[model samples]
Target: MKLIVQIPCLNEARDIAGVIQAVPRQIEGVDRVEVLVVDDGSSDGTAAVAAEAGADHVVINKKTLGLARTFQKGIATALSLGADIIVNTDGDGQYAGHSIADLVAPIVRGEADIVVGDRKPGDNTDFSASKRTLQRVGSTVVKTLASIDVPDAVSGFRAYSREAAMRTTVFTRFSYTTETLIAAGNSGMVVASVPVDTNAVTRPSRLFNSVRSFVLRQMVTIVRSYIMYRPLRAFMVLGFGMILIGLFPMVRFVYFYFTDGGAGHVQSLVIGGALLVCGYITCLVALLSDVVATNRRLEEEIITILRRMEHDEAARD
Candidate 1:
């Protein structure tokens, strides 16, 4: 198996080298293991240290494009290099390199298309207490919405097969680790989690409290991204909410309308009209959103299929 390990770095010169150096160079049945570093416009010597630590390849973006895009770029680079399995981990040394084999083994053995590393709270050292609790809660919420069960959704250490890398989208800039897992659940792919030990991350985290406003914003983005795949359901839920809200007014106006005529009738008519309008607007927007969403999904699928075909043709040569 050809495995390409990806490390997305941003101002990690302090610990990137150690992360790379710690990776085990060989795993059972794995003939090749290459390291690919994605530099997100870091001013520090992160790229330099990566090379020194024995990276097989590197891709540097002109500006700090954010973690999600940098991760996507890393996977693209690794795919171009013919990686059968892609493993992504932080450059901050939070995830132990020795745990990589455990992460990728499921994919190599065909037991799963995506292997996620779950940090059991108090069972691992790589996350702060605050991060662990929030991660567990976040995973629960996401699992409920996606109809998929996941143990740890915030873990950044994971492995993906070529099909997943080709099919999934890393669209968000914050809390992308969890968002990608949600995307996998919606993408008709099988996911598996591997338990691994990580020491508490020694660096400062970019994310804060789970109840913070920023966390809500990122979570909303993730939920909206998936709504593209289920516009009718989303609209129906919104419409139902509006209907429930209008019920009180509807009931009162109906009682008054039957007892009296002018003012009560007008009020009842206005309330009903408003509810109907809201329902109509939501239905319209859902329809429009679905059209655009379907187009984007089709384009993504076409490109992925062509890319896979090219890979097969090249292998034959």
Candidate 2:
């Protein structure tokens, strides 16, 4: 199978050359490797440097599209060029060249569709930086929001089988590592994390900015997907919770009204009316939410269709 290694870059002129040059060779039973460098509008000489370093494909995005779109373009281009599997890593020297073979094993062996490189900050012995204090916190919050259990959710190094790559076309345009895990799980692919080394970059790293933006995108994506994938489920949950809590007061007010004989208690009437109205409105909104959810799912399906066609044609070529 043809393998494409995508290195999404911003302004890393210093090590884009090194990254491309070090695209791991000689793993048993491996065939060809095509290294793709996505140059995300670097004002520096990153594109030139990657080309000079002999990258198989140098995809230069016209503008700075941020991290997610940068990676997506490379993925699309790689699929267009008939890549059977895609492995991605940072343009900085944080990821080791040797780790790629291990990353691809799960995909090649049919054990998983997406394999993530788990980067532990303890591996960063060189730099004074500790594990991102907010990284784990942000991940936990998003997990609660999205109902997923992914650790080390924002590391960039990963490998994807063709099936997984095709399914990711409908994802958030500005997503990164966090979003990828959720997207993979949403797409019904098994997502696994394997250990990898994270080291000081040859160039300064903007991964934290990339990580923060990615977390926001992931939250939005999960919320949107939550509604679309199961509008009925979302509605039932919110509506049911409110109904039960409101029921106690509602029943009490009704008994007081009937047994005590008609609008005899004006306060009870007002309170009951307000509670009922609020609960009904919530259920109504939940039902209407189904309509909105249908439209979103349709939009995602359209993107999926287009990308699927692109992927199939590329494989044909």
Taking all chains together, each candidate's TM-score versus the true structure is: 0.90, 0.80
Residue 225 alpha-carbon offset, candidate 2, angstroms: 3.8
Looking at model 2, report the run of 10 residues with the lowest lDDT sum: 122-131
Candidate 1 lDDT score at position 141: 75
Q: Find the 10 residues in a row with the least total lDDT in model 1.
A: 206-215
> Model 1 segments beyond 4 Å from truth?
122-129, 207-214, 262-269, 310-317
Q: Positional deviation of 197 in candidate 2, in angstroms?
A: 1.5
RMSD of each: 2.5, 3.8
How many clashes in each structure?
A: 6, 0
The local distance difference test score of each candidate is 0.79, 0.74
Tell me the lDDT of candidate 2. 0.74
Backbone clash total, candidate 2: 0
Runs off by more than 4 Å, candidate 2: 121-134, 137-149, 170-173, 201-218, 255-275, 284-306
Q: How would you encode candidate 2's per-residue C-alpha lDDT over 122-187 as one tens digit per residue?
A: 444554343455456655754664455655666678898887787775455555666566556655
